[model samples]
Target: MPAVTVSNPLALPRLPEPGLDARPRPVLAVTTAPSGVEGEGFPVRRAFAGVNQSHLDPFIMMDQMGEVDYQAGEPKGTPWHPHRGFETVTYIIDGTFVHQDSHGGGGVITDGDTQWMTAGSGLLHIETPPESLVMSGGLFHGLQLWVNLPASDKMIKPKYQDIRGGSVKLLASEDGGALVRLIAGGIGGYEGPGITHTPITMTHVSVNPGAQVTLPWRSDFNALAYSLAGSGSAGIERRPFHLGQAVVFGDGDSLTIRADEVQDSRSANFEVVLLGGQPIREPVAWYGPFVMNSHRELQQAMEDFQAGRLGTVPTS
Candidate 1:
C-alpha cells in the first residue's frame, strides 16, 4: 500500500424500484456470509453480516469478531492470510490487533480505531494479538468489512486508512440515549471523513428501550439493519429482532421502530452497517482467501498464490 491520498467522494449509481420476490429474500434477519476458513492454528468466525445476498454492489462482505470470551486473561487473534482484489476494514471497539502485511505496511490498532486496507492486486497479512491485551484477558469487540474494488481500480496500488475514533462524528437522539454516529456516508448532515469508492450509508445507532424512532432510508436502494445490543422492532408489521440478527426492509423511505418491551432497563446500543449501491451482478467465484468474478479468475488467483505472487506487504 502507498501513502493515503484524500480524494473527493465518488458518485453513486442510480437506484432501482423494488420488485416482488418469491420469498422475503431471507430478510437479512439471520443470514451468514461465507467466512471462517481454517486459520494458522484456530478459526472461529462468529458472524457474517452481509455479502452477495444484500450487497451485490459497492460492498462485498462484512464480518464481526470478538475476543468475547469473558474468561479473564485471554485475548484472541487471527494469524496471517492472503487477500487479493479487495479491501479489509477493521473497526475496533474493544482491545487491539497488530497487523503486518506483505505490502510493506504494518501497525498496531487500539480501541476505537478504524484501519481500512485496500489489497488491490495481492497481499499476505497477519493479524496477531499484542502480548499485553492477550495475556491480560482484554475485552475485544470489533468488525471487519470488505469493500469491492471497481474493475478499473482493481489492480491499482494497495493502501490503507488508519482513522482514529475522534475523526468520526457522533450524534445523539432526542432521548439522549439513542444515538447515531455516521461512519461512511452522511447522516443528519454529519458526513463521515474517509475515502470511499461508492455511495454508502454505514452508521452505528443505539436506541433506548421502548423508544419509538422513525428511521430513514433511501427510496431506491436496498436497506437493512442489524441488532448489536438489545432487541429492535421495525416495520409496519412491528417485527422484533434480537442481538446478532438483521432485518431487511421492503420498499419504503422510512420505518416505524421501537425497542422491545421485554428488556426495559438495558442499553440498546448496536452497530448498524447501512449499505446500498448499484448491483455489480457480476459472477462471483469465491474460495478461501480469494474472491473473483469468474472461475477462471479464481483459478488464476490460486495460481498466483501458488507461484508466490502474494509474497509482499502492502503500503499504508
Candidate 2:
C-alpha cells in the first residue's frame, strides 16, 4: 500500500482547504467490487463492475489487481493483447511490472510508478511480472484504469508515458492529516505529470487514523472514491465505506473523506483513490479490448486487430 509516502506529511505543501461556502459532495451510491480472476489467473477486484456508466464517463473500467503475496513460481501476468480507442493507466503500488508494446513504448514500473499507454489507433502490448520479481515472489498490488478517448481523438497517434513515483505532485491535507499523491490532472491549480486526452484527476490518498480530508473538486467533473485499504467514511454525511468499495459522489464543489479512529490491522491508514473527470457523454460501443463510439467502429477495430493492422508481437 506504499503507493507514495513520506516520514512527515507536514513537510509537504498543504492542500488548499475548501472555502466556508464549499458544498460538500453527497454520497450517491456505494458498490463493493466483486473479485474475479484476470489474465493468467491472477486475482482482481472489478472496481467498476456494478457502477453506472454515466457516472464513470471518460472512464471505462478499473481493476484492483492483487493485494496478494505470491510465492515463487506463482506470479502470473497477461498475455499479449490489443487495445484501441482508449488509454490504459497502470499504477503499480507494491511490485514491479514490465510493459512492452508494439509501438516500442515500454518499461519496468515498480513501487508507486505508473505506465500510461494510449492505444489511440491500436497496438499490441503485454504486461508481466519482471523475471526477478516472478522468481522471488513477493507483494503485488496495483490499479489499472481504462480512460476513454473522445471520438475525435480515438484515431490519433498512439503514445505512452512512464510516470515515476517521484514525479507525482505530493501534498498534505490542510491539517497535515493525510498524504496525497496526484498522479494526473489538476487539483486546485496543482497539476500532475500525466498527459491525457480527456480531462481527469487521479490521486492516491492516505489518511491518518481519526483524520479527515476535504478536497476542492471541479463541479463539472464527476467525482468518485474507491477504497484501497482500511476503513473510512465518505461525504459530509459520513456514509460508511470500506476496502474494495466504490463511492459515487453527487454534485458538489468539494468532497470529503474521514479515517476511522481505529484502522484494521492489515493497513495502518485509510487508503483511497480519488478519481474525477469531465463527462464525455458520448455513445460508447465497448467490447473486449476495444472501445469505440459506435458498434460499427468496434467491428472495424476487431477486423484491424485480426488482420494484424494493429501490429504483430515482436519476434524478439
**Among all candidates shown, the one with the greatest lDDT:** 2
Reference-based TM-score, model 1: 0.78
- Best of the candidates, TM-score: 2
Q: Looking at candidate 1, what is the lDDT of residue 140?
A: 63
User: Whole-model Cα lDDT per candidate?
Assistant: 0.59, 0.94
Q: What is the C-alpha lDDT profile of model 1 across 138-234, one tens digit per residue?
A: 4666677776766666566778888777776565544443445556676444576667655566666655566654545555556666555567666
TM-score of every prediction relative to native: 0.78, 0.99
Residue lDDT tens for model 2, 109-158: 99999999999999999999998888889999999999999999999888
- Candidate 1 residue runs with Cα over 4 Å from true position: 1-56, 70-73, 174-177, 255-257, 262-273, 313-316
In model 2, where do residues sit more than 4 Å from their true spots?
A: none
For residue 132, model 1's alpha carbon misses the true position, in angstroms, by: 0.7
